[model samples]
Target chain A: MRIPLKIGDAFVYGFAVVLVIISFAGMYLMGAKSDRRHVVIEMDKREIYSIEIHEGMEPVELRVDAGDGRYNEVVVMNGEVRIEEANCPDQLCVKSGAIRSSGQTIVCLPHKLVVRITGAGGEPSDVDDIAH
Target chain B: MKRYIAKACPMALAICLLFLPILQGCAINEVREHSKNLFALNTWINIRIYAGREGPKIIDSAVRRIEEIERRMSVTIKDSDVSRINDNAGIQPVKVHEDTFKVIEKALEYAKLSKGAFDITVYPIVQLWGITTEHPRVPTDEEIREKLKFVDYQKVILNEDEGTVYLQEKGMGIDLGAIAKGYAADEVVRVLREEGVQHALINMGGNVIVVGNKPNGQPWRIGIQDPRSDGVQQHIAVVEAVNESVVSSGDYERYIKDVYQKTGVRYHHIFDPATGYPANQGLMATTVVAENSADADALSTIVFVMGAEKGLGLVEQIGNAEALAVTVDKKIYTTKGFDRRLTVTNEEYEIVP
Candidate 1:
């Protein structure tokens, strides 16, 4: 049996299509927006500072003091972070260079300071842990 | 027309319902993550657990266990069992905690396995260089020779019946720094498994051990740090592991940076007891993967000092163990068992047969 096209049926089909499209778009947009990574600075086993990094963000310099006249100069610019200067004797933190990827860290053992990048961005991290 | 409209409505509703469970599954599959970052054993320790509700308590217990281990094993601690043994060297046998006794026994085993290449008595030479200490300097050859007399593992006498350790030489010392972290990691794993944690990651300094697979059921991926690069993410290769330990010893870990810049020579921490100098073997770093973390830890150092050919040979002789040696010339040599397990990610390094 043949049934004539009805306005109500057309409305139902259109609504379903729109709903599916919106759901997909919502997931995509949410993923894109959360791609911003975070740089966390920890001193003495406590998180002292945390900042988000994204494209086109202004560069920021932070002075982290580790008491007893020790400090590390941290620079965050262009989605990359590094210790530009440090008063620690080893100076290993300064030589560690810039880190832009998630799970990267700059550590000053003498000062008990750790600057690390953490967060689950748009994509998951490739590795769970690093062996060195 | 009414019947047709009824059918269309139900069809559209079914389509929406199809995706509802998928979105819900994403939320349901997300197991709670409990993590702790603390400094112990003179290095940063990071532990993560995926067990629900009971994770925090488990982590606390694990931290306390590590602290206790450090208290017993640390050489710097005033009255640690190791310190007591060092003080009583050549005079008397010092009774130690079971943990300390077990670690010393394991150290001696590795020392024998590697034919003294992995000596615990290298502590005197380590103190001489003081690379990890605030005052790191290249010791004079004469000064090193003086300290090398005490770098003999055979001189360390262990009594299993009495749980005591004695050193035959007065100045001789035993440093568990190489193997203690791995043992601590193994201890943490035991704690997590007992508490029914199926998925976890324990990184004691750079010694990494993964419990089971990831929460999502995929194998855990571990990156081997690039020895030439200082950036943490600069890994030369990646390896997938399941309930196994991966450890690497490299010159880049601790070194005299000021001396390196001026002289272009890195005076790193890992020392060769034979020469009383930094192991100048042609390799830059060595990584070991094994079922036991302590074995992997001690073997990494042993391999680094043994160089590529000998190290790879040693790894092959020991079944259920694998190793990768990165040469100073940007080449990687791996044991036969490492086939299909390691993937070289850096372009500069070539995997040589």
Candidate 2:
């Protein structure tokens, strides 16, 4: 048996292939950026320290003083940031647990301290505080 | 010929598919341009401005406006207007900028309303506690009691005509720490409006003042910082704010805890002028929403100091003002206006009617 080929059928097949190509191209162009974990610490509304998160890194402990006797202690281990302790009347930061994803922040208000994790191929998943 | 036309039709469609993403991307560019900047203004001033070609220019003007307020109002700055007023306490009356005079007058009004629950003249006690510095200590009762003598807002005499502020006693000092951020937020709003920008958000630390609806015409959602939030994104509630300011004052933000002593007492910076200590009104925090950020800022502190019941009463009395108070028991009480506007996200606390 002989098979007949139609130009219209060929065109429709070409259009389907082009659509898939375009969609994939768009997806590739918008694919996530580099995933680098960065732990940022802000005190009194200023970025005081930042470190890159990596595997096998020795545990780093940070003690921050807001100059008013308020103290915050933070621990970074195994690419996760945690508030180990704080002299704040409310130890909310210590209860905040270990966070590894971007946009997760452990905030100790008494100490005017904010430790945030950012950089995971996209913006951190924090509240959108557009209202300044 | 008909077959050829059918083939050409599909060919055209294929070409269209190739350029579809490019076309959509260009259309999205027509959305309003948003630009944000963060810098020091009393606190970390975070501002997001939305406009067209004038967006950058509008943001710059807003920054300048914030800096001017910070220069005049910041008590931390030794040469600021409030500092000069503090410097001349009892010795002489210091003339300040009209903005400073007006804010002092407003602070006095808040003091009168809360009956000194919120006092600008609590600086003497604030210095003794030094909650935000490295030397924060629970002062001796005699020391706090002595400083409490000067913690009278009524002692602050504001001469509107002369733009002068006078502290009645030698030790009396005025610290605008409670309401300065709100004033700064309002001033930034004024500048943004003057620049013809319709939509903007200004966060002076956690004092958030929003101007106009979002660029898409939706109301801006302002997160109420959870008093017990271990993380930044943890919000007890979110309010749909439109042309309003949402400010929260709480003991959690700046405090020194001495739990090791087993007294379980925490020393926070928000001083109760009457006691010369952190306000112990059974409230952990208060969030206020009002037309102006300054009012919201001061009222939040006042409400936190006033506790839940009286705070709700005052909030009800004030027009265009609403409040959300989190009690020591973790119960949330909100004004009728706020109860309707807020959406609670945290299940640990219950929002009361």
Candidate 3:
């Protein structure tokens, strides 16, 4: 029995294989994008800023004006975030130090400000929240 | 035959391409999370609901419920039920909302159970110390002693039939700082469950109450904050919880940092009603896990003030509740049932038998 061998059939098979590969690569990239960590800054429950954090990214400094002459200086570098300075009374946010892990937060009570790091892929520890 | 093969192969690829988006949509449907953040009761509150399109509306209702509770219970709110009761101390019984009455009634019960270890009438002492204020200081011994006179829970008179509260002494005040957040969390959980929400996480300033398992059918992992660590996410252990509340009372929450750095004495916020001073019990932090957030919230403070041995004893006596107490010496004492639920992640601390 002779198998049907035609150039047109080979072209069809090649196109099918290429289509499958492209779809898989698209799915893989989408998955990888969700894993990227982002720093979210919220003031009075409103998100004011957000930036994706990745390895070897350029350091960024943000001066958040919380009105009434109050301000918080946020520094994001090397995949970690910290409040470099703040005019708030407590200075607790500055003292919280650098937070790199997902679900971690630095809060300023006086300013009603919150800085949190979150990853869509979920944290390695899988912690939903910290009981303090 | 060759033409048929080519046509069939392209048709199959076209069919696969058409189904790709539907499969992705199914995967997205498995995890539907809607979260909202707000400030209430002098703390940050985060509510996440994993339900259908009604999640956002449910969260809005939950926030309104919290605000209502705060208005009735907050000491700082001028027209609040608590404020009215405090202002009328020794004058007459002030009618309060049922929520306020219920919370005070529950608080008094905890006070009686812990033998005054957790007293809501410690408000005068809390004001004197002002640890949560801008200028937290080490109050003089004389000042603490003066406020101690008004630090008795028995002075809070509750008329359940009238839904009223009165303080026997004019100087006495009631502050629900220790347990109000828990009540708020439980209220949120109740609302979520009633609205057909199967999975949710309600965090009222670290008083975490999880409703059911995660969307993926896994238990929620709640990190128990390490008392000695300054980082917000640092946890000595993680507890797997399902339809339960986890609350911790720790010296690390608020303190007089200047005094601590100078005198090596941490003037923290969790006060001992008996002494009108910060609880100097051997334990640095105490975590309570229970079916209700309010009970867990009050229990964490009771255990922290009572120390390790006595605290764990009270938890064991309660039967339904479990506690994890971390000593100043880095020793963790947990209830019998807690052993199976907790996984120690930090090696700096050791679990004691």
Interface RMSD of each: 5.2, 6.6, 4.4
After superposing candidate 3 on the true structure, give the runs of residues whose Cα lies further than 4 Å from its correct spot. Answer: A1-36, A100-102, A118-123, B1-31
Docking class of 3: acceptable
Off by over 4 Å in 2: A1-127, A130-132, B1-42, B259-262
- TM-score for all predictions? 0.84, 0.73, 0.86
DockQ of each: 0.37, 0.16, 0.41
Q: In model 2, state the lDDT of residue B342.
A: 74
lDDT of 1 by residue, A1-132 (tens): 556557986676676677767777777786675566889999988999999986578999999999978899999988878999999876778988887776667788888988877765524557887898
Q: Rate the local accuracy (lDDT) of all candidates.
A: 0.88, 0.77, 0.87
lDDT minimum window of 10 residues, candidate 2 chain B: B28-37
Q: Write the per-residue lDDT of candidate 3 for residues A10-37, one digit (tens) a residue.
A: 7766776676677678878977876788
What TM value does model 3 have? Answer: 0.86
Question: Among these predicted structures, which one has the highest DockQ?
Answer: 3
Q: B1-353, model 3: which lDDT tens digit per residue?
A: 88677667766876677567557656655446787778999998888889766678889999999999999999999999999989998899999999999999999999999999999999999999899998888878998888899888898988878888999988989999899999999999999989989999988888999999998999999999888776445788999999999999999878988898899898999999999889988888999999999999999999999998898899899786999999988989998868777899899998887
lDDT of 2 by residue, A103-123 (tens): 455666556677776656333
lDDT by residue for model 2 over B1-353, one digit each (tens)?
A: 67667667766776677667666666544435454435455355567777766677788787778778888988888999999989888898898998898889999998998888989998888899877775678789999889888888778887777889999889888888888788888988998888887888777877888889888788888777777663344677778888999888888767875531467676777777888878988888888889998899988888888888997788788765888889888888988756888778788888888
Instruction: Please give me the total number of clashing residue pairs in predicted model 3.
Output: 0
Question: For candidate 3 chain A, which ten residues in a row score worst on lDDT?
Answer: A118-127
Provide the TM-score of the second chain in candidate 1: 0.91
